[model samples]
Target: MSSDVAGIYARESPYLDRYVQVGIAQGRVISLSFPETPDEGAESEHDMLDRIESYLDGVEESFDDVQVALTVPTDQRQVLEAVREIPYGQDSSVAQIARVTPGLDDENDDDLRAIREALTENPAPILIPDHRIRDGPGSTPPAVVDKLRSIEGL
Candidate 1:
């Protein structure tokens, strides 16, 4: 896909690798190569960027308008508080929920309540890959199905 805007999301973990996607206001959409597992020794930002660049080597998408975004998987969200690079945000989108309520399923009701309260900050530019939005709401909003099954859940 050829578009002025491209976005990426990368993570380093056995459970979470990386994801890339490109989008335009109203044009072609591109989902760049997503490595199931990041290359060995890819423990730095530069290394991850190189890995991402290499992944996009053959893609025809426009990097000129590329807007890179990052997603710290639900498993890694809470730990991000110790890291200064990560930003926080609020909205009802799947990504936001995942970040704030990371592993919500495993979290106790009190933990979820705390997260709900912390979201008052409402961070902006909720960085997320374009493909995530395109991947549709199922995987992104995994709870939607269950929520829909019961109106009270919503």
Candidate 2:
């Protein structure tokens, strides 16, 4: 993808009680965060923001159509893709993800650690739905994960 950032958008989120910021590059979300304060002059017209609002409103919105730009190793990308397949309102364990991840031995300690590392390094939280992973929030803050889980009723 291009190194140029197309735009950065932010909007107040009711669920998190903070502003949700999204970074877009080449029509795909490159990053997501909950900043204490919204960036000055940041636009708030992206469709992703609209969908996020709908999701926070208790709607079972699907983020599958929302494209994301993840810059990580092949293994981590595979794990993140597997996590995306998890249905909304449901959760999965690390072992389950490792089992589904190709070339990863679920019973092996190193493989499991790799899975955990991938999760902990997840750059996009809500967009990738890391909170859907049971007992694993990756790098997402505990409060954000808890709020997201509450929103999904999990």
Candidate 3:
């Protein structure tokens, strides 16, 4: 059976957009993209939710879970909290690292927040290709390609 996975993001960064794409057949991420331009004018939260829902509808079936990777650019602490409150998974791989690392004076929960924030906050474009189905010479960083291919559990 096909599965569904959605990644919803709200970013003000000029380099990113709100669109996301993922692999549903095996619970793996394929790629993510954001519109180059932010939606202008006043938009209600419900309107934003509807937009996100439309993006997720591309999947073949109802997703087992919905995940959001939103980014807030201002003192929108309330928005950040709201994003966290959504019934979905928040990427915390970086956060977990910050939690376990011994204090060396340069890292903390705030640092983790920064990293996670960058995922959605900075508006950087991220494209995750389907490694199993696509390949090209010199298309990806050598180190990254090596690391991904070496993973035993990919």
Candidate 4:
């Protein structure tokens, strides 16, 4: 809780070594990471750790569905919005996501590749829930993507 601290607060699984690292600033979560290895700022004190711990209303559930503010390119916002509509435990391909997207400069069926590009550039993967994307559209690291899918039982 000290402004001087520049670190992440972790919330670990009670029976497993796995954990989630939450990063917050100005009342918004800037990042959420579930990794086998800690990321750059993987240290914290009790106050911040307490906040992270409170997010777990369900011990086995993944809170990746939560939305947060992200600084994405103006054009990519539509793509992200489309992606956010994907139901949990389900998925949509890049082409499918693009087909539903509005305000795209070009909504051609051939824009699958471009849609894929926009998804990979996501700054906040879990909050954006990019892992719900299928067939390699929007993406996160393969390992973490697997973790997301497994956690959601997709």
Candidate 5:
């Protein structure tokens, strides 16, 4: 976590039917959450928020340009980076992700497990778009995944 930060922000999301919260540091997204209640006095205006709103509205927005600060281990980070490459409104299987992930033996079951674990531990859901994964939603709520996929018309 950088010392310089814009602080956490929150906004009610009609698509998810929850309050979306984000923690930002040095202009990079560090955390994301869907809370039942909004944080008091939390800032509600951010470029990311607008992007998410637009995406939920079926704009086919791409989050590839968004800067995200990840603190996972090297292997998981590599897997996550590959997951991020899954284009908007599209999906990839865990095997496919493992194949594209750097330093991984796609034929190995352990590598496939690693990909699943990385996605399950994803720090930012929509920013990373783990819902675009085909097999499952990792740790993201299944309903959220369904909603996201529905919005994407997938």
Candidate 6:
């Protein structure tokens, strides 16, 4: 995984005890990681990083235009696409996402668990915005989700 990655940059956000690390590849975001403690370094000068920090600061910014590269299986990718469709300042249940997901079998052996699994493994938390998904933890840390919800006034 490290070999395939081109570069990673870190930036601090007062919103949490962690700094956001944005992974880049071919000029697009490929991964996003939030660590408990930020490393000593310059904040990223990347446009996407700037946009996210601005949005967290209550700026009128929408990440909907930012592109992400999901290096996952087809079914998980489909689930992620549905997760991305969740509008800003809104929420949806996992069942709702599964209903819109074509590759998902919402009835077979209780497909909700599969859907939950996919969202839990999402690499791009804010970019994919898994926190928008309702009814449970939905991938990211619970505290982070709560913070995001508060940030969006949801």
lDDT of 5 by residue, 1-154 (tens): 2324578888898778887888888888888878878778778887777777888788888788788899999898898898888888788888888788877876898888888899999998887888989884475677788998898877
Order of models, best TM-score first = 2, 5, 6, 4, 3, 1
Tens-digit lDDT track of model 2 for 34-88 = 8879888888777788878898888997689878899999999999999988899
Best by TM-score, which number?
A: 2
Ranking by lDDT: 2, 5, 6, 4, 3, 1
**Residue clash pairs of candidate 1:** none
Each prediction's Cα lDDT score? Answer: 0.30, 0.85, 0.31, 0.62, 0.82, 0.77
What clash pairs does model 3 have? 17-34, 17-35
**Model 1, 25-133: lDDT tens per residue?**
3232222233555444323333334433543342222232333322334433342221212222111433444354445542365544444333322121112221222
Q: What digit string (tens of lDDT, one per residue) describes model 3 on residues 1-154?
A: 2223223323332111232222222233223334444335312233233433443332222222433233444433332332233222222244333343344112565654543443344221222111211122222334433433333123
| Residue range with the least summed lDDT across 10 consecutive positions in model 3 | 124-133
Question: Over the stretch 29-73, how does candidate 4's per-residue lDDT look in tens digits?
Answer: 566666666666666453544533542332343444444556677
Pairwise lDDT winner, candidates 3 and 6 = 6
Q: How does candidate 5 score on lDDT?
A: 0.82
Candidate 2, pairs of clashing residues = none
TM-score of 3: 0.22
TM-score of each model, paired residue for residue: 0.19, 0.91, 0.22, 0.66, 0.91, 0.86
List where candidate 5 sits over 4 angstroms from the true fold: 1-5
Q: Pick by lDDT: which candidate is best?
A: 2
Looking at model 3, residue 151 earns an lDDT score of 34
lDDT of 6 by residue, 1-154 (tens): 3323457777877795577888778767787878776555634666777778887887755577777888888888898888888878888888888889996665664678877888888988888888888774555778878888888777
Candidate 6: lDDT of 107? 67
How much does each candidate deviate from the true structure in C-alpha RMSD?
15.6, 3.1, 17.2, 4.6, 2.9, 3.8
Give me candidate 6's TM-score against the actual structure. Answer: 0.86
